[model samples]
Each structure stands twice: as structure tokens, then as C-alpha cells.
Target: MTQRIIKLGEGYGDVFELFTLMEAMPDRVDRLLALHTIKNDEERTSLACIFKPTNQGNFHPIYICLEGIPKPNDQRNKRYEMFKALSEQFDKPIVEFTVPPSETYHEEEQYFQQIIAVLRLNHLLPPI
Candidate 1:
């Protein structure tokens, strides 16, 4: 299968925007993955969420969130919690990463490259 990488930005409410987009194209999603960046290095706060395709014909939408979730040093992160809850509700694992942000790259493109790299490294994405 040919996999396409999409870059998401952090606008006023990009999370909500992403949700709305996925809701609109539920069937097109083969899997959902997310990467959330944290602020501090104490606990290592990067996270990745994955959604797998089911036999029941349900949609699998991956969400890769970066620079969104606040660090534990600050107030609790509702957005991170929400993604966690959603994963639990859908029986998916909220995978975590602890890598630094991409260097000398635009936010959106960098995010896309990161996700695609992860998928390829994990053998989740077929050679294209």
C-alpha cells in the first residue's frame, strides 16, 4: 500500500481542526498515530498514539501531535489526557517518544518527516 504523510500545524485550535477533518473522512484512515512533544527532560514527555484497522470496518485515524502537550512542569495537560482517553476508549496504546525536535526545519514539514520516519523504521509503512 502507498502511504501518504500529512503535516499538521499548531493553529489556534488545530487539535479540534484535526478531529473535524478525520470525522469528515473517517473511512480513508488506515491507522492513526500521534507524537506529542513535552517541555522538560525530567520525565521525557514525547508521546505517539496509534490506531489500527479493525475487522469490523471501523476507521483508523492516526494523530501525530508535536509541541502541543505541555510539560509536567506546568499545569496538567488536558489535550494529552484527551488523546489518552480516546486511545483507551478505542483500545489503542498512547506510544511515547523522547527525541528532540527536528533541526533547521519548518514546523509542519519537520513533523511530517518525523512521523514518516518513525513509521518506516517500525516497518509499519511499506517501501514506496
Candidate 2:
């Protein structure tokens, strides 16, 4: 199986679109993830929607709104609230954890690889 991170943007206006797609295709939705991290001394989160492998191809796509939302425990946010509600509606608990700051990586691809590995180890993503 092949897995890839399809970044939408940092959690901003793009998160609403992620919610819409999740509502539209519940069947394709595999998991909801919240990656918590401390960047510049502020707690932040990255929300992601993992889709099941494609029917014809072994392509597992993980749609993400990269680190932008504030962690509820740190600071409540409307965007994060919506995601929490959406997860409840889908009956899937959000899988969350801390990861290295994105700035630690020299390239976006490197950052994605780190996230992908974390997902795979947690059994959230298929192995390569």
C-alpha cells in the first residue's frame, strides 16, 4: 500500500472544506487525527482526515490542514471545536499526539514523511 499526505493548507478557511468532504463521504473517511506540537512556545494542532485506500488502487490519501489550530487545552478555538463536533458525529475519536515542529524540517516533504511515519506506526496509515 502507498500512502501520501495531501495538504489542504494550515487550518484556516481550508478546514471547513475538510469538514464538508468528511460529511459528504463518511464511508471513505478512515480516521481523524490531531497532531499537537509546541511551536515558538505556543501549543498548536494540525487536523487531518485519513481516507481509506482507493477501490482500484492501493492509494491511501491523508488530507490535512497543517498546524494552525490552537489545542483546546491550551486555548479554545472555534475551528477546533467544529472538528471535535464533527468527530463526535462520525463516531470516531480523534487520534492525537505531539510531533516535531515543522520548522525542524528543511522541506515540506520531510515534514510529511515524519507525519506519515507517525501515522503508520500508530496503525492509522497503511505501510509502504
Candidate 3:
């Protein structure tokens, strides 16, 4: 199985798109993630949703709104609140982790690979 991160924009509109994707395929939803990080001295969160691999294509796509929302612990935001509501609707707790910010990586793909490795290590995702 191949897993890839598909980044949505980093803004409110992008978050809406993420929610739309979830609503469209609720059955395929595997995990809801809140990746917390400190960037430029400010705490931010990346909201992501992992879907089960497609039956025919075996492609696992992780949809993400990267570093867009304020960390819930620091300040509550409407977008994060919407995510929380989705978590409730889906009956999945949002899994959270503190991770290196995207700036730590030379390329965005490297950053996503690191996150995939972490998920696999924790048994949240299947191992390669």
C-alpha cells in the first residue's frame, strides 16, 4: 500500500474543503489528527484526516490543512471547533502529537514522510 499526503491550502476555505472530503467519504475515514508544532515562536496546528486505502487502487491519501489553525490549548478557533465536531460525529478521538515544523525539512515531502514514519511506529498506520 502506498500512502501520500495531499495538502490543502492553509486557510479557512481549505478547512472547509477538508470537511467536505470527510463528509463525502465518512466510511473511509481512518484517523483524525491534530499535529501541534511551534513555528516562528507561535503555536499552530495542522489538521489531517487519513482514509483507508482504496479497494482497487490501494492508495492511502492523507488530507491536511497544514499549520493553519491556532493550537487549541493556546486559543480556540472556529475551524478547530468544527474539526472537533466532526470528531464527535465520526466517533474518533483526534490523535495529537508535537512534531517538528515544516521549516525543519528541506522539502514538504520530507516533512510528510517523517509524520508517516511516526504514525507507523505508533501503530496508528500500517508499516511498510
Candidate 4:
């Protein structure tokens, strides 16, 4: 199956767009993931939604909001809070983990490829 990478803008505004995509296709939502990483010595999170592949096509699209949310609970970030709320609304728990920052990779594509590998190895995503 082919997986499409869709990246939206950062911060709270972009979160609305992510929610809208989910709202439009509740049944397509397969799972949620929260990737935690340390960037510039601060804890950050990347919220992602892996939607099911098309029944008639070999496309599995993952919508991700990059490391814009603060991971610390003591720090209030409405964007993360909104995502948390929606996760509860859909009853899909966020599968979280700490990973190497994007800077560690030579390019953004390499970073995402690593993530896909992890997802497939764990069976969150099917082997192609």
C-alpha cells in the first residue's frame, strides 16, 4: 500500500484542519499516535492520525501535526488539549513514544521513513 504524507501548519490553527479531516471520515480513522522528542532541550510532541487505506486504492494517508505542542502537562497548550479532547471523543487512544528529533536525520523524508518502519514493525501499519 502507498502511504501519503500530509503535513499541516503548526500551532492551534492547524489542529482545526486535522480535526476537520477526521470529522469528515470518522470510519477511516484507524489509530492515533503521539511522538515525543527533545528539540533544542525542550520536550515536544507530534500528534498523528493514521487513517485506513482506500478500499479501492492502495493509499494510506497519515496526517501529522509536527512538534509544536509542549509535552509537559504543567505547561498549558490549547492545541494539544484540543487533540486530547478529540481523542476521547473518538475513543481512540494516542500511542505515544519518545524518538530522535528530525534534526538527527539528514532530511525530513528520512525521518518519516523511520517512523513508518516503526509503525509497520509494531503492526500499527501493515507491511507493504
Candidate 5:
């Protein structure tokens, strides 16, 4: 099974696209995640949804809206509210955790690899 992060964009307006993808394929939805981090001295969150691998290709895609929304604990935002609503709508709890800021990595790929590692360690994603 191959797992990959499909970045939608920074949470800004791209968040709606993530919602559309989830709503359009609710059955394939596996998990919802809230990755929190402090960037530039501000607490932020990245919203992501993991989808089950396709039957034919076994390609597991993790769709994400990278750090753009304010951390709910620090300040509530409409985007975060929408994400919570989706979690309730899908009957899936939001698996949230604090992570090192993306800036910690020299490349975007490295950052994603760290996230994948965390997921596998927690049994959120299947181990290799």
C-alpha cells in the first residue's frame, strides 16, 4: 500500500475544496486530522482527511489544508468550525496532535514524511 499526502493548499480558501472532496466521497473517508503547530509565534492548525486506498491501485491519499487556520484553543474560526461539523457528520472523531512546524524541514517532502511516521506509529495508518 502506498500512502501520499495530496496538499490542497494552505487552508485559506482551499479548505472548501477539501470539504468537497470529503462530501463527494464520504464512504472512502478513513480519518479526519487536526495538526496543530506554532508558526511565527501564532498557534495554527492544518486540517486533513485520510481516504482509504483505492481497490484497484491501493493508493491511499491524504488530503490536507496546510497550516492556515488558527488553533481552536487559541482562537475559534469558521473554517475550524466547519471541520468539526464534518467530523460529526461523518461520525469520525478528529484525531488531533501537536507537530513541529513545517519550517522545521528544509523541504516539504520531509515534513510529510514526519507526519506519515507519526500516523503509522499511532496505528492511524497501516505500518509498512
Candidate 6:
């Protein structure tokens, strides 16, 4: 039940990389959740998909896209719009986070570790 979060940079190529990462982790994840923030929209949208379990008893990994889309206070972007459309197809609402992007972590591993720590603190991630 361990949960981890990773953020992608606001780059055109990042979307593909993130997609590939999530697709490769289907056997290790339990759920996939994606959040997209679109411009001109007052609210955000999320899409979640549940994948079949693996023969090794591993669940599909969940993925959330928190990049490219501008914050509520910032200007809108096309990436968010794309995510919003995908979210609708998944039928999940995108949730808003009050916390801004972390500046201390320079590596994706560090970012994921921080997210895992937060999930553990909130009891959202299983203790291992």
C-alpha cells in the first residue's frame, strides 16, 4: 500500500516520458490517478484508471500528472487542457493542492521520496 508521487517538468517531451513510466509500472501499481489543470477553467479535473493485477500479485501503478498545467493563479496552458480531456474520459475529478512545487529537491528520486514521506505521514501509504 505504499504510495509515491512524482512530478514532471513543464516540457513538451515530459508528457511522453511520464506516460511511458506509468505504462511500465502497471504491474507494480494499484491505481492510476491523473490530474490536469487547464487554463480558463476555474476548477481542475482528474482521471483515474484501474488496471488488472499481475501474475506476481502486483497491482497497476497509479500516475498523476501535476505538471505543464498552470496553477490557479497562473496563466493557462494547453497541457492542462489535454489532461482535462483525458480526465473526463477516466471520470475522475482533479484535486487541487495548496502546496507549491518543492524547490529543495533537484532529482526525481528526491521528489518521489518526499511524496512517499508525505503519504506515510498521512497514513495514505502502507507502512513497509
Candidate 5 lDDT trough over 10 residues, lowest sum:
68-77
Candidate 2 or 6, higher lDDT? 2
For TM-score, candidate 2 versus 5, the one ahead is 5
Candidate 5 displacement at residue 4 in angstroms:
0.6
Point out the worst 10-residue segment of candidate 3 by lDDT.
Answer: 68-77
For model 1, residues 26-79, the per-residue Cα lDDT tens digits are 454344454434334433233333334444644333454445445444667665
lDDT of 3 by residue, 55-99 (tens): 997998999999988888746688999999999999999999999
The residue pairs found clashing in candidate 6 are 29-59, 29-60, 29-61, 31-62, 32-62, 45-94, 46-93, 46-94
- The C-alpha lDDT values of all candidates are 0.50, 0.86, 0.93, 0.84, 0.93, 0.46
| Tens-digit lDDT string for candidate 4 (75-103) | 77777777788889889998988889888
In the range 1-128, model 6's lDDT, one tens digit per residue, is 33344345545566656556545653443434443444344334333333333456343233444444344335665655654554464454444334324344597577557655654475444565
Clashing pairs in 1: 32-61, 32-62, 33-62, 33-63, 34-63, 34-64, 35-65, 48-95
For each candidate in turn, the TM-score is 0.58, 0.92, 0.96, 0.91, 0.96, 0.50
Q: How close is candidate 5 to the true structure, as a TM-score?
A: 0.96
lDDT of 1 at 20: 60
How do the residues 1-128 of candidate 5 rate in per-residue lDDT, one tens digit apiece?
A: 89999999984889999999999999999999999999999898999999999999889899999997888874668898999999999999999999999999999999999999999999999976
Q: How accurate locally is residue 53 in candidate 6, as Cα lDDT from 0 to 100?
A: 39
**Rank list by TM-score:** 5, 3, 2, 4, 1, 6
Candidate 6, superposed: residue stretches over 4 Å from native: 1-10, 16-69, 72-75, 120-128
Give candidate 6's whole-model lDDT. Answer: 0.46
Question: Cα deviation of 47 in candidate 4 (Å)?
Answer: 0.7
- Using lDDT, rank the candidates from best to worst: 5, 3, 2, 4, 1, 6
Task: Give the runs in model 5 whose Cα sits over 4 Å from its true position.
Answer: none
Whole-model lDDT, model 5:
0.93
